[model samples]
Target: NVMNVIISKKSGQPTTMKLNGVVSTSYSDSAFKFNKDFAISTDTTTFTLEVTWRMIDAEDGSAYDSTDTNSFKIVRSTRVNQPSEGYLDCWERDLFLQFNGKPINAINETMNKLEVVFTTNSDRYKKVSVDITHKSGSTKDSLLALPLSENDSGFSGFFEREVGAPKRDNVLQHSDPDSIILIYRNPDNPLDTIRKAYPFAISKILKFPAASYFDKNADGKVDSIFIEVEGPVDQEDLEKLKSSITLPEPRKFKVNSISVVKGGIALDVTEQSNEIRTYVSPTDKIIVNSGSLPAGGLIEGNIINVQDKVAPVLLSGTFFSDRQDSLQVEFSEPVKHFSSKEPILFSHGGKTYRVELAENGVFSKERFYTSKVISVESGSAITEGDLIWINPAAGIGDTLGIKQLNPENRRVPLKVQEAEYEITVRTVNNPMKPDKPVPPEVVNVFGEKGKKVPPNGVVIVVEPKGEIKNKIKMDEGKVSIYDVVKHLVKKDIEGVFDEGTQKLYFIWDGTNEKKRVVGTGTYNAVIRATTISQKTNNRKTFSQIVPLGVKRK
Candidate 1:
C-alpha cells in the first residue's frame, strides 16, 4: 500500500510526500512530519491539502484499481493556537458595501449586471477589492483602484473620494465567462485572515437603473434623487445623468376648474399635472399658465391642490342697520386675525377710521356667506362708504400660514348707503288699563312687551313698511345686508314679537341711551328701535326712530 499527501499555501502549488505502508494486527501507527519546517510565512494566511490512497494486491502485481484523492483547506484561527506556538489574532475586517445608497440584499439587484460595488467603512484597510464567483466554479475577483477618469469633474457628490488616500480598484471582475461570483478581498494584509465573502448573485438581471426621489418631510412622495457614484462630474454630465435616470413617468396633469372670481381664488386640482415628471408632491398646488380668462369666465379641466397664496379678500361685508356698532365681513377663506394685531384703517370721504375688534372681540372660527366670517364690533362707528383696509401691512394669512397678498383688494368698500330709519313715538296719558288675560302657568321667559307702562315716557311702536320679518338682501347668493329689529331706545330688545300683530311696542324713560335726562326744552324722545336677528350680531341699529314731547310738571 502507498499513502501520499500534498500540502501547499492556499493560493500556491502543493508539495507531495509518498510513504510505504504494511499490514498490522489490531493497532497500527505511523508518524511522519514534513522535512521542511512549516513556518507561518508573512504572505501565507491559509493552506490546502490533497490526500491520495491506493492498495495493490502484491501477489498478483495486477493492482486492483482502488485509488482515491481528496482535497481540503484549513484556515488559521487565533483562539485555536497552542501555548507553545506564537499566534496572532488576525480577524477579517468588516467592509460595508452598498449599491445606490441601499444596503445590498439577496433580493435587490443592481442596475448594471456588470457592476459590483464596494464601500470601505473604515480607513484601516490600505486596499479594498472584490471577487465575482460563478456557480460554475470560476471567480473574477480583482482589486479596485478608485477615482475613475470621470471623477475629474464635479460629480464627486455621488461618491466622495478621500483625498491623500490610496486609489480604489474596480472590483467587477468579468474574466470568468461561465458564471459570475461576488468575492471581496483585502489582499495586502499579512494577517492570517481570509477575505469577507459577500454572497451575491449576478445572473438573469435587468439592464436598466431605477430612480426614486426622497421626501425630507415624508408628507407624501419623494423630494430628491441622491446619486452615489465614485467620481466628479460637471453640470452637463449631471444633466445627462439626471435625464438618463429612469423613473416612472409622472402622470399627466389637467386643470380642474379655472374661473375669474371677485373674491378668493383657487386652482382646484383633481390630479397632478404632467409637467411634473418626477413625483406628485402633496405640497404642490398651483401652476401659473400663460393664457388669460376674462372676468366671470369659467374654465374646467383637472384640478391640483395648492396653498392659498392670495390675499384676504372681502367677498361681502355689511354693517347692521344705521348703527356703526357691529359689522360682518366674509372672506374667501379662514383668515388670520391680522386686523386685530395691525392697524385696520377705514377711509370714508376725507376722514380715516382705525377699525379694530369691538369690546365683544373677534372669533377664530366663524363663517358667513358660505365662507369664513369676521363679525367685528367697531371701536368707533363705521358709517357708509367707509373703505376698510384689513391689515394694510399684509399680516393676514390662511390656515396653512401663507400670507395674504395684493394690498389694494383687502379693503372693504362700504358701497351700499346707510339704511334709512324711521321711528314714531307717542306719549299716552293713561298709565293703567284692564290687565290683559294671561295664560296661567305659562311664564314669559322674555319679559312682557309694553308692561309697567311709563306714564310720561314715550310708547314707541315700530311697524315695518313691508312684511319685514327677516329681510335678507343678497347679491349673487351672498347676503348684501341682513336687516331686522334690533331694539327700542332705553329698553332691552326682545326677540319674540307677535308676527300676527305686526306692531312692536317699546316703553322707555325720556332719556338717551346713556340714561342722561334732558333739559325742559321740547326734546324729541327718540325711541331707538333696532332691526331683528341682529342680536347675535349685536350692534346699535334702529329700524325706526320716534320723537315725543314731555311737559315739565
Candidate 2:
C-alpha cells in the first residue's frame, strides 16, 4: 500500500506519490483521517502481511508492483504514527482448493471448499468472481493435469482439506480426482518428526477423479496446476517441481549383486565356504562363478519388481566363500519371500521387501547399504534404519528387472496364514445319479384310439405338442411328402389325397395354374412326426404306400 501522506489544507484534494518506505520529509494540503477499524495503529501496529498464493511469472491473480504501471491500489488507513514498514492491506477473499497438501490452479479444480483469502490491494473486493477450471493435456499438448506420485513443490497441486464447505479442521482430502500422495503434518503429533523428514516414504497414494487444472498464461485454457507445499517444503531459496508427473522415481536396493542364483528371482543365497563366488547377470539371474571348491550353500529366494515393498528375508547367519579366499563373510538375518506387491508375508520383520529394477536403467541406494562383494562370506552386512534397494542393468534377463533378496529367518513358512472354506461346490460328487425326465408320469398310446380314417388323405389340424406333426405320409407308392413339409421348403410330390370331408380344405379361388396332378403313378406324401416340443427339428418320419382307386364306378 503506497500511502500519499495527506495533510490538512484549505482545499479538499487527495494526492498520489511513490513509496519505498523511506520518505524523509512530506507535506500535504489535506488531512488524512484513517479508518481505524482496519487500519494500522500508529503506536502498536505489527507489519504482518500475507498473500493467498505465491505469484507466478506471468499471472495477475496475486500481488503486483509499480513496475507494471497498470497496478491496483490497496486501501488502508493509519492509526499509529510509526516507522517505514508498518502497513496492512487486505480486501478480497479467495477460494482455495488443494489435493494432498497443495493449492489448486485453474478453474473447476476438485474443490472441497471455496477457500477465501486475499490481498487488500484490489479495489474490487465486494464484487469478485472466480472460475474453477480443470483440464488435462498431454506432453504434446501442454500437460495440465499433473500426476499424483511426482514429488515436488511449487508447480504441483495437492489436497489439504476435505472436499466440501470450509472448516477449521477436518479430514484433509484430495480436492480433485487426480491421484495424490497424502503426507499429513500435525504440529502436535507424536510422530510429527518422522512425518516431515521422509514424508513421501511414509504416507500412502490414492487415485481419484477431479476437474481441477490451470492455464498458467490465462489463455482461457487451464493447462496445468501449481502443486503447492503439500508438506513442509525444503527450506530453499527456490524450489521446483518434479521432471514429469506421470513417471515417479523408482525405488532402490543395496546388495552385493543381483542375479538368479540357485533359488528363483529376487531370492537370497549365501556361500557355504570361502571357496565359491556368485555371479549375477544384469537380468537379475544368479549363478555360481568359478571359486576354489565348495558345495552345500544355503539359498534363499527373492521376488522383486513390486509396486509396494515390505522387507526381505532373514538368513540365520549364512556364510559366503569364493573358494579362492578362506575369509567367509556373514549376515545376521535372512530376507523374505512374498507373493506379489500385496505383501503376503515377510521372512522376519523386513523380510518381505519388494524390488523394482531401474525402469530407465538409473537409480541406486545409499553406499552404506551397498555391499562391495569382497571375499566369500557367510552373510551380507545390513544395518538398521537403512533403506536398502537394488538396481538391474538395462537389456538384461527377464525384461530388465532388479533382483531382490530377503531374510528367510523364520523357518520356511507354509505360505498361508489362516484358512477357511465352505461346502458350496458339493465337495462330494457321486456319479451324479442321472437326472429324471420332467412330468413324473405320461400316458403313451401308439396310435389314436378315436377313429380310423383312410391314410390316403392329408390331415390338417392345429399342431399338437406331439411327434405327429409331419411324419404321416400319404403312402402312395414308395416316396411321399406331407403338405406342411412340401409347402415349407420347395419340393414337388405327385398324386392326390381326397380333400375329403373338408377336414383339411384347400382355400383356392381358381384351378391350379401349374396344371393338375390326378395321376395313377405312386405320389409320395411324406409327413413328419415330432417330439412334444412341436419343433420340426425335433421330428422323425415313417413311410407307407397307398394304392389309388378312382371311385370304382
Candidate 3:
C-alpha cells in the first residue's frame, strides 16, 4: 500500500511530505516524515493534513486503487511551558514521537519528530525485529529497545507515551505485518532500569502442524481440531497461538463473516515423542458438504502443514433388485472388515441396520484402489430416498490406511415405476409476443408420478394453424406421431423434477434451423412423456396436447 501526505495552510501552497515508514513491500507500513524545513510554521495553528493511499499489485505495478482521501485535522495542541526541544506530541493514538528540543505545540511538530520503525519480510513464517534509531535521541534505554517478536515490546514505549501504545502485540509471530508490535516505556527524569532489562529474542520462527477432524455424528460438519509442534512450546508463543488461532464458521463458498464459537471448549494440550499437541472441541459444529473443509484459518498463522490434509470422498454404491435384500458399496480405500458380528453396522432414519455377507460378498485386502466391494443383505426393503451412512466405529479407512475420523455418507435415490402416468402442457405462450425476434419462453410440462421418467422423456411437435387436415391415428395408450412433422429438437427432451414439489418444468424457445423463429401462427402442441420400467428397463410413454398462439408484435 502506498500513501501520499499533503500539509496545507489557508491560502498557501500545499506541501507534499514523505513518510519514513516501509511501503509497497506488501506487508509492512512505516511512518511518514518530512525534512526539518518542511515543518509547518509554528505560528500557523489551523491547517489540514490529507492522506491518499492505494494498494499496488505486487505481481505487476497495476493497482486496484481507490479515489478517496482520508483527512485529519492537526487539532490545536495546548501550549505547555517547557524547554525548546522538550515538548510532548502525539499522532492520533498508536504512534508517539518526542522531538528532543521542540516545544509542545502543533505546527513545528512536522516530520522533525523521530518515528520508531519496525520491518519484516513476507506474510508468513519469518524472523522479525524492531528498529528505533530512526535518528538517535536523548533516551538511551528507548534507543536500545528492539522488537522481541512481532507482538512483543521493550522499552520503546517510554519515548512515545504521548502517542498511544501499539494495540497489536503479535505482528512478528506470523508472516503478516498487520499485527501491532508494542514497545517498553520508561521515564526520562527518574529513569527506571527494571523495565530496561526486559529481555526478548528478535528473530525466531517455530514451524508447526495443524489438522481438522470430521464431526462424529455425520451431521455434515467439522467439530474437532488439532495442532502439533516439535518439542516443548515457548510460553509466549503458546499464548500468541491461542489468541491468534480462531475457528471460523464452516462454509462451502467464500464469505467474510466470522465470530468466535461462544461457550466453546478450551483447547487441550498433550506431549508425545518430543512433540507438543493441542486439541479443541467446539461448542458448536461447522456444517459442510462432501469435500475438504477449509483450512485457511490455520494456514494464515503458518501453523498448518500442507501435507497433512484429509479429503472425504464417496466411491460407489448401487442397488440390485435381483436380490431384493442386497446392496453393494465400494470405497476408494480398504475398510476394516465387519461380518455378521457387529449389530449396529449401518444407520439410516435414526435406525441401525444389521449387515450379513451376501453370497457374492468380497473383502479385498488392498489399500488404495481397493476391490473390497461390500455386499450386505438387510431385512428391510430399501425404498426411495434411502440414504445410509456407515458408523466410523465400524472401521472405514482413509487412503493412508488409517481409520477415517468421519467417512463420507452414502446417498441412495431409488428409481421406481408408478402404475399410472400423466402428462400435460403446464404452460406455454398464448398469442406470444417475440422480443428480439423470438425470445425463448418456457413451455412447462408436468409428469405425474414421473419418478421413473426417462431422459428425453417428453417429445413435442408444433403443428401450424390448419395443418391437421384429418384426425391422426390414435391408440388406447399411444399417439401415432406421423412423419408429416418432426419434433423441433431431434434429441431427447431434458427436464428437472422436484420430488418434494412434484413439479416438472420444460423449456421451448421456438427457434430452430437457421435460428429462425416459427412464423406467427395459431398452433396445436402435442407433448409425450416417456419412461422406462425400473425392474425390466422397458419403455413406457404417455401423451397429451395443448393449444399455442404466437404474435410477432
Best candidate, TM-score: 3
Model 2 agreement with the true structure over 30-102: per-residue lDDT tens digits = 1123223445454444432211112233355343222211223343456534448554333332233343344
Displacement of the residue 56 alpha carbon in candidate 3, Å: 51
Best lDDT goes to which candidate?
Answer: 1
Error of 1 at 220 (Å): 23
Model 3, 1-553: lDDT tens per residue? 1131121111122223222221222222223444333344455443333433454655785755333334332333467455495555321112233335332222121222333323223233233233332111212122334433343331122233212223333211211112222332323321111110111221233334444443343332333444444323443333445555544332222222222232222233221222111112242232221111121111123423212223233344444443243455545444445443321134446555554434334555442121221344445433334454445554554444545445444333333223343333444334455442211221222344232322221223322123221122211122222112444422233444433333334434444345446666554545555543333243445566555555665
**Candidate that beats the other on TM-score, 1 or 2, i.e. the better one:** 1
| TM-score: the better of candidates 2 and 3 | 3
lDDT of predicted model 3: 0.34
Lowest-lDDT window of 10 residues in candidate 3? 190-199
Which sequence of candidate numbers ranks them by TM-score, best first? 3, 1, 2
Using all chains and alpha carbons, the TM-scores for the candidates as numbered come to 0.25, 0.15, 0.30
> Could you tell me the C-alpha RMSD of candidate 3 in Å?
28.1
Clashes of 2: 127
